[model samples]
Target: MFEKILIANRGEIACRIIRTARRMGIKTVAVFSDADANARHVRLADEAVHIGPAPARDSYLAIENIIAAAKRTDAQAIHPGYGFLSENEAFCRACAEAGIVFIGPPVEAIRAMGSKSEAKKLMEAAGVPLTPGYHGDDQSPERLLKEADAIGYPVLIKAAAGGGGKGMRRVDTREDFLAELASCQREALSAFGDAHVLIERYVVRPRHVEVQVFGDTHGTCVHLFERDCSVQRRHQKVLEEAPAPGLTGKRRGEMGRAALEAARAIKYVGAGTVEFILAPDGAFYFMEMNTRLQVEHPVTEMITGLDLVEWQLRVAAGEPLPLKQDQLAFRGHALEARIYAEDPSKGFLPSIGKLLFLSMPADGAHVRVDAGVDEGDVISPHYDPMIAKLIVWDETREKALSRMRAALADFQIAGVASNIGFLSRLVACGAFAQANLDTALIERESAVLFPPEAPPPDEVFFLAALTQILGEQGVKGCGRHDGWRLNGAFSRAMAFRCGEFENTVEATYLVEIYRFALGKRSVSARGRLTGKMIAAEFDGQHVQAVVVAACGALNIFLDGAAHKLEKLDPLDVAAEGGSGHGGLLAPMPGRIITLLVEPGEKVEKGAPLLILEAMKMEHKLTAPATGAVRAFYCVIDDQVAEGAELIDFEPETI
Candidate 1:
């Protein structure tokens, strides 16, 4: 094994690589940008190097800086851990020129497989089955439109050099083709620095299944089964499982062989994934090849009992394949849920803030957590908003799923919005449990997945009020004579704002029980706090929840959902309610990519007013109602904070 290897990435994948490298008796060097100066990966590695600024182009994606860091530390190899420059051909070539081993595939493979259009032609030549589409080099908008018409409606415009759902859009009609194409190109250029795209037939009901294949320099290759990544949103995977459910042995073998063939065709080395789109009729077509470790590799690791990162290192060091194809066996079913600092209720926009309180399910032989953040860690907008990956394993898929549901419910975070509750609901849905999954599963089950938004139970708000008063007066001293009269009860009023709505809660507290009224509804609850947890009995039902008070808000986690109640005074509530005037605000912290309306320009309701690029996705801010742009506060290329006013609109008269 190499003495020292530099991890050319950040966040969870970098930390993940460091753990495996340290276990193999190898020292690891972590490179970080200014944004990740105090990140977990930096703390975990044996040594760390300052790369550049917070922006990825100045840091993680800077090939020269990474190579220089490796050479300065005298590291023998560089492990590009699945993002940024992991699949960049220039990074691999630079590593070779710097005399450092690149713990991944060769530059030829990376370049050959980098462009989707070119890769399709190569795959076709290699006899790999491809979906019918246009993989040509015509970059003109008119040509693409003609190609789309030729292919058919409901086509997918995919960036030639895209992954992780970036730079992809589905066009259902010719009228929407040009606009969608422009959006795809802009995102593609921003993400991969490549604006070229290819048109393909959008598979309506296909399952995203990928094969885990490994190759060694000694000309040996093997496949480690498949993972079903069908449950997705915004074209990105939300949940993944190993040994794709319902696939027959014969079909599995065929997919594995095809994956091996794809690897062999490109002379691929190290760990790579060949993804496919499987139709309902049992037919599958090659989607694309990822030339590095996948984000969902843990599910494969859980099933096969193999360490893919270690395998990457071994293969990079010229070691033979660890195990032959015949020797490999999948042990059990496993599932992984990607925990992101995103609000599913808010169109899945990325949320940036400090993690006030973070608690995860206990890890055991059957459950594991691969996380990149800790309590009090700041989730910035400079990179991906992923908080962690929760993996669970069991003898069967049903057990694994059940375990995952329980694990998700146990996972908790505060000070930033998360999708834990949404994920829990998704896994518990009957369709998901029945394994009837596809890329459009989330959309098809939208009604159930995204239920009507209802305020947390009145009891929850009552608890929030009780906790706020108790915390202010000291929970320990509360039972003492702090607010209790001779009647052994004290009354208090707590005002709070939930999103845009405000409510005032009145409660009378006793030693271990409280009666509260909210919006004309009254309830009585018996609750006590033991260290940060509140155990309560309401409506003859017992419940326990984790609570954290920070940033003038009481964040409570009950039954897998996070509720934030801002403790506001009456004046603050009035100010908040009156602050809204038909102005466009930045939904999240991001740079203004484009402004569709100029000052004094008239726009219709729901018109695309501006585009904000954040968390590697472009979100359009539309007009709330038909209005005239009175003034502009931001322009293209300007970075703004979340909720900052971007436009001041004059509402049109009816």
Candidate 2:
């Protein structure tokens, strides 16, 4: 076993690797960028080293810096958690040349599976089932268009050297093929520095299932069953589970054997995953093999009761496989939900801000939380906006689903928008509850998952008002004791705003409860505030909630939903920025990649204006109405902050 190791990554995965290393009595070193100087992983590791600036290209992706850090810290091995340099073949070779162990598959395996085109060829030769597509090396646009025509409409153009849903496009018609291909090539070059692409026949109603396979240097390899990652958005997984809800025992065995074959074909060592696309007719085809640990590996761990990271360390140290296929035993069902700091209502845009308050479900035998940020940490735009991974396990799939719903309800976050509410609805939706899952499950159940917005219930406002009033009363020498007049019931008015609408609540102090009136409604309310938690009763009904005051607003969390209400100050006067005369502002902080319409150009309503790239995804800004471009506030490659004007336009008169 290695005495010491360095983790060449950050965030939850880095923290996760450190915990397992500590358990194994192995000292761990952590590498961080400027943005993660005080990150959780840095605080947890035995020793920390500064790598570079905030951008990944200058820091996490700097292989020489990471190699030097490992040597300076005297680390015997380097574990590239899951991203960054985890799958980089050059990094693996660098470790070997530097006399340091790379705790992953060999460079041969990574190279074999590095390119989607090459991986497909290997899988074809290994007798693994493959989907019908074109993986040829011809880069001519004419050749690609010809291939697309032969493959029929609705083909998927994927970057040959990409993962994580980047550099992928699904074209539904021949007319859109060339444009989508150009976009995919641009993204591929930007993300992976490889513009080569392949065309695959788009599979309809497919489920993404992958098998976890491991190997050792002693020529032994085994399987750890499979995980179903069918619930996705934009081809990225949102929820994952172990043992796959509807997979038959016979099919599971077949997949396990196929995965073992794929591993053995490449002489693979350490941890790797063989992903497949399962069609509705029970036929499965090879997608691509991930050369490193998967983000959703925790579900496999919860079911097997084995530390995969520990296994990686043992294998990298030239040890035999811990357990063979027959000895491996797994039970129960596990589910994982990726909690991200993005707003679901606004096209899932990334949200950045300081975490004023953070509360997650307590970890226990049935629940676990793998998080990277603390209460005061900032969710910078320079990295992925993931908040945490919430995993739950139970004896059966039904029970596990129930446990996940409860855990999500217990989560509370403030100062940044999150997908907690969207996840809560997704788990409870009828289609998901019944395990009718596919890649399009999110889009299929959009109605239930994203209901029409409605005004918050009266209880939300009541709770917010109560929390504010009670908090103010606790301040020494600043509270109004006159509300307790003995001669008569004290009366006061409290005003609040929710977006553009405002309301005032009238309160009369009585014996033990307060009578409140809002518009034409009246209710008697009483509540107790216990350190940001509230247990309240109104009109003979009981409710429990959490309230957080930050960013000049009162955030109320109740029953898995969050409501923001700003307290109105009558003596203050301030005007917010409204419509800027047909100007389009940046929705989030990002760099402009392309300007489709130049200044002084007339465009129709809904025409594309420019493309803004943020959080590793491209979003096209469009014209709000029939207008002519008057001026451009930002040029291509300019970094702009949230709400910064991007374009100014003049609308044509109706």
* Candidate whose TM-score is highest: 2
lDDT of 2: 0.91
Model 1 TM-score, 2 decimals:
0.94
Please give each candidate's TM-score.
0.94, 0.96
Q: State the lDDT of candidate 1 residue by residue for 1-654, as single tens digits.
A: 899999999888988898898898999999999999999999999999999999999999988899989989999999989889999998898989889999999999999999998899988999999999998887999999999999998999999999999999999999999999999999999999999999999887999999999999888999999999999998999999998999999999999999998999999899999999999999999999999999999999999998999999999999898899999999889999999999898789888999989999998999999989889889999999999999999999999988998899889888889999899989999889999989999999999999987777766676787677556556364456345687667887778877666678887776656677887777777667777898877656788888888887888888777788888775542324442357778888898988887788998988888899987899988887888888889978998998999999877776
Cand. 2 TM to true fold: 0.96
Score each candidate by Cα lDDT. 0.89, 0.91
- Please list the residue runs of candidate 1 whose C-alpha ends up more than 4 Å from where it truly belongs after superposition: 475-481, 486-490, 499-504, 509-514, 517-527, 537-542, 570-580, 598-605, 626-628, 651-654
State how far residue 448 of model 2 sits from its true place (Å).
1.4
Q: Global lDDT for candidate 1?
A: 0.89
Number of the top lDDT candidate: 2
RMSD to truth, every model: 2.5, 2.2
User: How many backbone collisions does model 2 have?
Assistant: 0
Q: Please provide, for model 2 over 1-654, each residue's C-alpha lDDT reduced to its tens digit, 9 standing for 90 to 100.
A: 999999999999999999899999999999999999999999999999999999898899999999999999999999999877899999999999999999999999999999999999999999999989999999888999999999987889999999888889989999999988988898888777789999999899889999999999999999999999999886778999998989999999999999999999999999999999999989999999998999999999999999899999999999898898899988999999999999887778889999999999999989999998888998998888998999999999999999999999988899999999999999999999999989989889989988987678788888877887678778889857426885889877888887556778888877778888888999999989999889999998999998888978989988778888998875566887655458789988888988998799999998999989887777788888997999999998999999999999888776
